[model samples]
Target: MLKISEVCCEDEYDSMKNYEKTPVLMKRAPFWSGAAVQNAKLVNISMKDFINKYMVLIFYPYDFTIVCPSELIQFSDRFEEFQDLDSELIAVSTDSQYTHLAWTTTPRQNGGLGGMNIPILSDKNHRISKRYGVLDEELGVPHKAIFIIDNKQILRHVSTSDMAISRSVDEVLRVIKACQFVDKYGNVCPMRSPCDDDTCESKNTKDND
Candidate 1:
């Protein structure tokens, strides 16, 4: 997997830096006692499933939309990579489970994500999205938001982008790995490399006027 620096361009890196510092409160992942897609019964999806495990929570704009399917399929194709890192992928939208099932059952040629192993959580009431501050009240759909929650249920990383742009799956995996590295080593990250001359290393480093 590519490092976070390679995955994100300079502008994206600056944006992510600001985003990381923003104080946005995230609600705990909901425990839903509802039916999963394809007639699979689900009592609830708890934080425990992700507590000790790395997790990627993806909140899309909406289902059955123009850009949604492409992003979904891209994530599905790389799902194994996430699994290799011992992370669970939970995709959420305001769409109902019936809609999720229909989309999953539909062929990829027909713009549906066929046979996706990742769990698609329903936020039909907008409760979850609202809690995450991704809900677009006017459109009633979620904006593109991704959260990397560590094993302890603490919000480690959060990002939201325009509805049009699809997120980088590789970068998401990298962040998860970085977070896991931090968790294991306490402070130092194996992937944190020395800054180059052009990069600022301290808060006191001033840009040349």
Candidate 2:
């Protein structure tokens, strides 16, 4: 396995690209790693770290953009909701970790993300984005996309949108709930409504102690 390091050589990247196949629904997600800015510090993060828990990868076009901050901050504010559901949200962009940190330090009033609750992953090499097939060849940035990986590392859901559009975090949460419901109960979840306590645990219900 090609573990992500602070400075992955180009040869390593090529080997990874060739070694790993493209991501497919209901299949294991492609393993990836890179530097991430979390809580004002740079850290090495990888898909391996998120194993045994649901991982939500949110790939946005860029930092300091109009719709990007809104989506990021919303996810950050509602991070506990995801945590309650046994999931982690990771925000990724082509921007460098330093840029991610700078944007985090900037206030929302001035169009900054403001100390995000989730780790902001830097896809500066563009390899991770490309491996996921969200990279825009023309724009040199990723399209707004979300990949939900289950505890078993199987990709359960994926959504992609153009740069002009922003994703619905609530909808993502509902989908996650539905995914969990299906996994736990082996029943079909309704399209519009989330699985309630009658069929499965309520979204508000925290994990049992």
Candidate 3:
């Protein structure tokens, strides 16, 4: 079996100094808005609009970079899996929306993003990255970070990595499934216990669907 990825508390809640961890855990996620390019269209979107849905905010360093494009395209390819599980996935970068569209429209053979199914949000001003605590101040780009917000708008999980490391799409899927399982059954998920694992009685039966 593949090992599940581990996330650090510091990476998850770096901005929560002087506050109780419990309260911080229950606090609503910070609100944000920016232009996004999705399915070859540009539009305005906000975090508030995704209320009542599981929201995954993926923060990467930049567009037109090697590691970033693979991650974005992977997530875009598996986007419907998130939707099927009642979640929304959004990719955020400091790149402008116009750049996002250009990259998506560019052919993959030319080392471009070809096509992207999910929204790629523009955080060109870095406000959202700063608020999320993923900004690399010296570099003016965010660290590789993933924030999973539950239906109530409470942030449930967060993971961050340095530029050299890439995140696992499979691991992210397992996490959201675990979150949903716990939310439905009120049972705790042990470490490495994926929702589909037979050992976990809390596993959802409909998971095979």
RMSD to truth, every model: 11.4, 5.7, 8.2
- Candidate order by TM-score, decreasing, is 2, 3, 1
lDDT (tens digit, per residue) of candidate 3 on 1-209 = 11112212334544646332212444667666889998889999876567678899999887888888888889999999999988999999999999999999999888789888889999998878877878887999888989998887778898888889989999998999888877866767656655555645434554454
- Give the whole-model CA lDDT for all candidates, comma-separated: 0.66, 0.83, 0.80
Looking at model 2, report the run of 10 residues with the lowest lDDT sum.
Answer: 1-10
Better of 1 and 2 by lDDT: 2
Global CA lDDT computed for model 2:
0.83
Q: What is the lDDT of residue 73 in candidate 1?
A: 75
> What TM-score, computed on C-alpha atoms, does each candidate reach?
0.72, 0.85, 0.82
Please name the candidate that would achieve the greatest lDDT relative to the true structure. Answer: 2
- Write the residue-wise lDDT of candidate 2 on 1-209 in tens digits: 22234223345556653432347899767667899999988999888777678999999988988889998999999999999999999999999999999999998899898878999999998888888888887888988999998888778998888789878989999989989877865656766555664434543353452
On residues 31-120, what C-alpha lDDT tens digit does candidate 1 reach at each position? 222334532334345344454566777889777777888877788778899888788888888888888888888777887777787888
Worst 10 residues of 3 by lDDT: 1-10
Higher-TM-score candidate of 1 and 3: 3
